[model samples]
Target: MSSLRQALSGAGAVLLAVHPTLAQTAETSAPTNASAPPPLLWFLISMLVLVLLVFWLILVALLAWMRPQLRQIYDLPTVHDTWSGRVLGLLVGDARLVKGEVRDELLDHDYDGIHEFDNDLPPWWKYGFVLTAIFAGCYLTYYHVLQNGQLQGAEYAAEMQQAALMVSTTSDDPNQLTTYTALTAPAELSSGKSLFATNCAPCHGANAEGKVGPNLTDEFWLHGGEVNHVYKTIKFGVNGKGMVAWKGKLSGKQILQVSSYILSLQGTKPANAKPPQGEKEAPAKTLAAR
Candidate 1:
């Protein structure tokens, strides 16, 4: 018995020592086990599904109980006379609900031995006709009698006037060709000179002599010699050439000033002038005649 007790005590000690290792191993594996969904969540989801199933069953049972009573109510004459009931009846293929009942009493007139029942128009059709008449009366009062709304002609005219105003305000059309004579006033010329020196000097040279661009001091112009032509060239640059469009960079007045300034540089004969490339323009007096 003592030996058996000693053996039992040794086994108990061994179990105590292994308990901590087992607990440590379980702790280490806890994160991996946590990947599975919790039991409580699954239980809650199952309960929700059970509740929905019960509710559906109850609803089905209640509908079954009330179906015969609902059919009886639907068959009543007073129910069939109502609009909603008539709509329902029509859906169920009962035309008598919407269309007036057929009468056995025939009219005096007969065509080709066929007797006429003389039934009234359908209720739905009569209602639609009455609604149309009401709409017509309201429309006449609003547009003609009260004169609160504009007629088609007046509305069209108003829209056209608005369109004209919008068009008048917008003048910067790149495709449109414009014409203007050279500015001769001393102040205007001075402004033009200042604008040209600041903007056109890099390419055309500070003295209007040719550099990377064509000479402005000469009568020869690659585009055109006229002041308006120079303005057009400055506003819309040549695509393949080095000329950059100055439309957004310069205002209309500023562009006109620069053009006038360039024209004034004509016949100045700047030093180291580039040879003329374009056809010579007519004399100023003759050009002005056109």
Candidate 2:
């Protein structure tokens, strides 16, 4: 027991000496200057890598899903060797290029998963494009440059004003094929009035007072009162509304004269006239004011 105790005391004395030296060295060492970094940065880097890997996997999956259908509908070609192909290459920015040295091998091309045009662009498409260009050029020159045109602004306005004036000034004259002097010619109206009295008086009364057919000369012609409307009624009579086409019965000239005569009754009053039919015109004075 005493021997065992002596051995223990020696080991304790040795441990005490070593502990002081270790403590002094630890105090001088400055906390090992910094231990190696934590594994957390590695874990973060691993997680980033894992997320990227998962993203790439998803992208690959989507591409795989659509690839088969796209493959059937279209053949994905590598860069080609034609004019359109060159344009596409220009648009895409980097395409396969062939030098003079490579041209021979390129020409000897078998189906290396790419194709090229063996024929030229269609003749119709080429000519059509040329025609379109020419047409565009002509249009630009006419509208933007020369201004000599099918319809110029001043000329069109002048023509319209002239036409409208012609229509209005000689409105009563159906056949303006001659001068306006023919307006007062008796031959023109005598036949029309005669025809109206004979054919139309039986239905409408002698003074064109309404009985069977509506009144005429009473500021109210049944179908219409204007020269054009009257002429139309006489020429192509209404069927359902009891007017009949008179083109065959009366000459076009006779119809025109009758239309003119009806228009002339603008101011003349008839006794016991039927009330005004269609849209009434303003009294001539009001019309003139307008």
Question: Highest TM-score: which candidate?
Answer: 1
Candidate 2 residue lDDT tens string, 1-290: 99999999999999999999999998877555453345667888999999999999997787668766544333335534444554444334423322111222233355867754344444456777899999999998997789767557778988877776667435243323221111235787777678777766676656666556775655544554545556667776777877777778988777777656554455565676666566555432222110
Off by over 4 Å in 1: 1-170, 283-286
Estimate TM-scores for all models.
0.40, 0.33
Over 85-158, each residue of candidate 1 has an lDDT whose tens digit, in order, gives: 76656544567766767667789999999988878887778989999999999999999999999999999999
| Candidate 2 similarity to native, TM-score | 0.33
| Candidate 1, run of 10 with poorest lDDT | 281-290
Model 1 steric clash pairs: none
Best by lDDT: 1
Against the reference, the lDDT scores of all candidates come to: 0.80, 0.60
Clashes of 2: 2
Candidate 2: 10-residue stretch with minimal lDDT: 96-105
